[model samples]
Target: MEADKYVVVMNSEEQYSLWPADRAVPAGWAVQTEPNNKEDCLDYINRHWTDMTPASLRKG
Candidate 1:
């Protein structure tokens, strides 16, 4: 089987998720960067996405 491209996505709540690179990102989700392989996407998320709380609920 061929490898699939992937994308790292994020939501208003600051949560991170993975999506198929060939597919359209769902509403309320934004692409964090250009499409990459699964491993790259996971690495990006690990480097970022430190806060899991929703922006409205996070305290300074």
Candidate 2:
């Protein structure tokens, strides 16, 4: 069996998501880190994406 390729994505809102590495990324979102397997992608997001608020809404 072949493993699936996954990439970590971030939005203007600072939200993190896992997407397929081969597919086209959606507008308003960009790749935040290198691609990895599903587990790695999830782990990275869990550790890094501590805040769920958008950049504009977060209090400084």
Compared with the true structure, what per-residue lDDT tens digits does model 1 show for residues 1-60? 544898899988888998898888999999997888889999999989787777778954
Clashing pairs in 1: none
Worst 10 residues of 1 by lDDT: 51-60
Query: On a 0 to 100 scale, what is the lDDT of residue 56 in model 2?
Result: 82
Q: TM-score for all predictions?
A: 0.83, 0.85
The sequence of per-residue lDDT tens digits that candidate 2 reaches over residues 1-60 is 444898999987888899899889999899987878999999999999997777788855
The total of clashing pairs for model 1 equals: 0
**Best candidate per lDDT, number?**
2
- In candidate 1, stretches whose alpha carbon ends up further than 4 angstroms from where it belongs are 1-3
lDDT scores of the candidates, listed in order: 0.87, 0.88
Cand. 2 TM to true fold: 0.85
Task: Say which candidate scores most in TM-score.
Answer: 2
RMSD, one per candidate, in order: 2.2, 2.4
